[model samples]
Target: MDTIIQPVARPSKRGSYRRHSDEFKRAVVAQSLLPDASVSRIARQHNLNANQVFAWRKLFGEGQQESGNNVCTLLPVTVVASVMAQPVAEQAPACGGIIELTVGKARLRLEGAVDTAVLHLVLQRLLP
Candidate 1:
């Protein structure tokens, strides 16, 4: 007896990007969160042509700080000023700026003159 083989699947095309209101996203995500829910079926019921329901579900779940063993904390960050290096200057001037990061009751403040390279590196590592 001969067995039939399934063809390989190619990468699916991503549809156009469109912004949806927070209420709409929340509603869709809420429906998708139900037990035994199907994202495709939900999207179809909503009449959305894009394949962004899964993305929306993830986006709405951004507040979740747990991932099995590790606990990821979401911090609040505020940059009062931004500094950039001068390509021509041998030494960059001390651009004093306040960078405040707050998570719950914890707060981190970087005041006074801060190094541009260091600040850039710190932000790169900290932010998503």
Candidate 2:
């Protein structure tokens, strides 16, 4: 019996493609978060992309205070106060007048004519 052998696939072609060390990732994240340090500049200096540094920072940030002392207890009250402070928008004044229709020299006018039938006919003519 004859057996066939297949070649093993090689790793990525991007030159060894080593992941940055934890310490290096931390340093990059720290520098990117500094008061004046821009993420794009920091990423350029570290040979990385802006998105990569941002992802690391987000992954390592605090979710909530470990002490658990109600950090957001006032959120509901603050939201309610903001909603109550706004004034309602004023409505537009109604214009009540006779409707007029003129086709070539002919003219038709009606006061307070019911619109349902006319609207239906107009819509049916306009649509397929």
Candidate 3:
């Protein structure tokens, strides 16, 4: 008995080809953020399918927060990075040797003059 082999079908350039660079991919993902900008427009501009652009958008959106957090940790750089990354809006004005920071409407009071050592202890307890 003889067995027949079938050739694999290739994607057609007219309906299948999609080209994207690192810069283009980032731009497309960013531009696709607006509710009005259809995925097709972004993908077409970058020679990509609507589905491809949509996927990129989703991946990048989900990753943005994690990437920002990594910058805060900066384990490979400096330990101070984590402290410095504290969001300013969450911090309350220091008064009478006390400082307050809010986390989701829950008040985190840092009492007394917050020296580096004390701050470190507080961070260890609060963050860890």
Candidate 4:
């Protein structure tokens, strides 16, 4: 009895490389910055290489810095009050109090009512 053998498949002579637009790259980088986002997972979802995404972030960041658009923007924050068994009168402060803040390696003690303008100026000088 004679057996038939199948020929092996040959690879293509040319390799295909995809080019992504700047807008698309920026979008992917922004997505990767979202809270709880994983770079590898995002790249997989977008059919991109994790390294490519990281490179895009670096490149985009450099561009932003050069254009003076690297200033930090404040994100919206939420404050949640916890319920207590005790009454509010007992827990409430009698008057304005002092608070301690740790900014970078420096510690600041702000007592009584804090001036928003002063605090803003101090923070602007303290932070990067």
TM-score against truth, every candidate:
0.35, 0.37, 0.37, 0.44
Off by over 4 Å in 3: 1-19, 62-128
Full ranking by TM-score: 4, 3, 2, 1
Task: Report how far off residue 37 is in candidate 2 (Å).
Answer: 1.2
Which candidate should be chosen as best, given TM-score against the real structure? 4
Clashes in model 4: which pairs? none
In candidate 2, what are the lDDT values of residues 52-76, reduced to their tens digit? 8888888656233223343333211
Candidate 4 Cα lDDT to native: 0.73
Encode model 4's per-residue lDDT on 9-95: one tens digit a residue.
998788688988987888888888877989999999999999999899898783353222346645344343444555644554424
Q: How high is the CA lDDT of each candidate model?
A: 0.69, 0.60, 0.62, 0.73
Error of 1 at 125 (Å): 35
Please identify model 1 stretches exceeding 4 Å from their true place.
Answer: 1-19, 62-128
Question: Any idea what lDDT model 3 has?
Answer: 0.62
Q: Model 3 over residues 1-28: C-alpha lDDT tens digits? A: 9999999899866756456576777777
Pairing residues by index, what is the TM-score of model 1?
0.35
lDDT of 4 at 6: 94
